[model samples]
Target: MNLRNKIAAGTLVLASATLMPFLGTWEGNGQNTVYADKLARGLPTVCKGITRHTSPYPVVVGDYWSNERCEEVERLVVQKGQLQLADCLTNQQIGQNTFDALSSHGHNFGYVSTCASRAVGLINAGRIAEGCKALAWAPDGKTPVWSYVTDEQGRKHFVPGLHARRRAEARLCSQ
Candidate 1:
């Protein structure tokens, strides 16, 4: 092949590589994808705030996908993700941040799974005692709400003010 042909072929190869991440996905957040489809069916609310799929190729050619597009994939997905249920919030940074945020609000006790995770991460990160005392809002388990505990001692515990909120996680724990 001539120099021009060789360069063109190489460029095409690179371009295809960059496009691979966006190749098979849905269309939201300007081109989202379907992840954890089952989860979406079961829980639409959680997905409402997350966009599906992470781009192995999340570049914007002047605001479009192009070049080395992967570095920002985690940032864009996590910061601005509104995914569906069973959408695998694991890799999404937005998921992590959401979880961490809800968890970290020390005085409040009503948090879902994501919120709980965030709190624990922040607490542990801060070298705080992450236990029943970590939360000042937990009440007796009778209020139909509760904060979740790590299953370390073969028993579950709750914080003061989180009554009804714990109900959701309780059901999951039983199963």
Candidate 2:
């Protein structure tokens, strides 16, 4: 079924059908394992990037998640994220690809932050292509942003993985 049709069916439709595989590619389906998120200051994360903040259950360090439980929680979290993102968007008629891309961004960076970003401003102004490009670039349109992590020493360091993910998100948004 198409995205619009799925939307009409229920909120559960979009996350499971469209965004799951897209997110799985980037987030990595960790299956039954729980690990620390180094970038987020060692927050316990499990099953396709479910952290304590996003998880319905308390994320314990050694807890094991079954495949079914992981999928269920991921779907719930992604759907909640989609609703949060939709609330922040002024242009509700954006295409599925654009929405999915933005949802991915919202998933990684909080929806509130995504709402306040320059990319959202550009998209609201009806410059979608430029907005997509803005997801990966700074105001200079050359330097990349959102591709670094601050360490305990308060120093910012470049992360190749984040850079790649941002570029991939931009491509998805442009589509």
Candidate 3:
């Protein structure tokens, strides 16, 4: 083959290899799939024991049903994560661990938030550890688990139940 043809073939091979891992199915043990599965498991399909929920979409109060399956939840969560990631972090390559960690955060909250932007900036700047720490600092983008704000009635309002998730996301990012 000529030099031009060789270069073209090499580029095609590289592009295909890079995209294949994402496009291909996991069959059972993909990291992102497993991560998504674990994260979405605790979300209730029946909030307050009456209101029903569905995957890949938010829960509507009036439209409640209890027929959604577990596999459907996993698929929905993964699809949402992928879509969120695609929308926010476009045209850039990310490692599996980073992808999984960020996807977890995106799944829990959203990708187009202040926290996600900070994490993306840190990761893009090659400050992986700092980025991971930032993510742990603000899992929900607006509230860090360690923060406490005083309400108008002089009561301390705390954002509970997020520290653990933040820690988990940080752990995944560092890995």
- Top candidate on TM-score is 2
The C-alpha TM-scores of every prediction are 0.20, 0.90, 0.51
Model 3 Cα lDDT, one tens digit per residue, 15-106: 12322232222212222211222223333332211112324455443343333433344555555444546455432444556556666566
lDDT of 1 by residue, 1-175 (tens): 1122322344212212212222122113342222332222321111112322333332222333322233245334433222221132222222222232222221122223433443244333542233222233333433323344445445666543234333322322222
lDDT of 1: 0.29
Q: What lDDT tens digits, residue by residue, belong to model 2 across residues 16-114?
A: 456778888878866567888898789898887899889989898878998999988998998888877766666644677778888888888878888
Candidate 2 global lDDT: 0.80
- Number of the candidate with higher TM-score, 1 or 2: 2
lDDT of each: 0.29, 0.80, 0.47
RMSD of 3: 10.8
For lDDT, the strongest prediction is: 2
Summing lDDT over every window of 10 consecutive residues in candidate 3, give the lowest-scoring window: 26-35
